[model samples]
Target chain A: GAGVSQSPRYKVAKRGQDVALRCDPISGHVSLFWYQQALGQGPEFLTYFQNEAQLDKSGLPSDRFFAERPEGSVSTLKIQRTQQEDSAVYLCASKRTGRETQYFGPGTRLLVL
Target chain B: AQSVTQPDIHITVSEGASLELRCNYSYGATPYLFWYVQSPGQGLQLLLKYFSGDTLVQGIKGFEAEFKRSQSSFNLRKPSVHWSDAAEYFCAVGPKTGAGSYQLTFGKGTKLSVIP
Candidate 1:
């Protein structure tokens, strides 16, 4: 694709329900990343992948948050037992192996009520 | 842990006026710095970055930023502001992991409003 793409531009989930967000990175990009942005705040790192290898996931807020990139080209972020505090925008980004710039997706706004 | 700070919550500049947005960062070692702009309902667009070499780095859309190691600052500037330039600006610090992957730490962001 021309740029990173995320699915389900918006989501509404009841508290305690599970939600899964998806990301499709640009073709041939070797690095992928996930971030969470709260209302009126900058995006915060959640996890990173280098060609299917989960290199780092230190920024994930809690055990309920999980992410995977089994095939390297696509990724998913799943949140279990969603809470009101889980309301935020989930962002995905990807970049070439030798590049510093990461192309971002439109983001998925999740609202837990 | 590295962190970024965008001191100004909001800034209003008239069209054709010079503009500067302040940023500060905290890290034990030299860190990669970046500036990104975000319009409403849009993803962030990179404005500039500083990894090494000359302090002043130029970016797209007539944007530039200077990295000052002494003050731990990377300030974004433009010679003339445009109404189209109104957006939210974020400052970020990249802390390279052991494998060289950059996990970015971003500031809250400064909202820029341009007055025509």
Candidate 2:
């Protein structure tokens, strides 16, 4: 079975540029999550979605960070005017309904120069 | 708010040696604890989780964690660690919600270096 997968495994962007990271969760997964991991640090929650509805986005750092799962399957995390501080590995995870374990994706490594 | 702590930033152990990784968490209520492993350039892999019931929980790759509510700790251990066990270990606490969401607050991680 395919686990969660993210597109653009590596992204290099200049400051002030915008980037979009995509995540494809497992088929039939009802819950999706996004997290950011800095160098030598653990992943931090960014946003969560239950189907097409985003339930928690409190972990989004700023307005520049926005995510949406419009069709209830694929989700996108967009960063506007990318900054050096926004450089990190963005991870995606998904889980089945009524399950607690989360399967993670390989993640997109974003580097803002 | 809610937070997790991995006291050891790094640990070195010889292959076939017993190993233990410390983790502690703070939450207002009963917390859901988890352990995850990450290899270089890889996604986080679930090792084990303790939501309730038995304090001792077993996971993949011969890993286990003991959740101690009195100490607010969930430490991961292995009877004998293999060289492949060298990786970054993370401790996380999931705040229970009425909606049954699994949002995790993670620790800084402990890097394990296994010696041959």
For model 2, residues B1-116, the per-residue Cα lDDT tens digits are 88888999999999999999999898988877889999999999999888889999999999999988899889999999999999999999886665546788899999999999
User: Can you tell me which runs of candidate 2 are displaced by over 4 Å?
Assistant: none
**Native contact fraction per model:** 0.56, 0.78
Compose the digit string of candidate 1's lDDT tens values, residues B1-116. Answer: 78898999999989999999999999988888999998988888889888889999999999999999999999999999999999999999886434456777899999999999
Among the numbered candidates, top TM-score falls to 2
The global C-alpha lDDT for each of the candidates, from Candidate 1 onward, is: 0.92, 0.93
Residue-by-residue lDDT tens digits, candidate 1, A3-48: 8899989999999999999999999999999999999999999999
lDDT score, candidate 1, position B41:
81
Model 2: DockQ vs. true structure: 0.77
Docking class of 1: medium
* Top candidate by lDDT: 2
For all predictions in the order shown, the interface RMSD in Å is 1.2, 1.4
User: Given the true complex, what DockQ would model 1 score?
Assistant: 0.70
Chain A TM-scores of each predicted structure, in the order given, are 0.98, 0.98
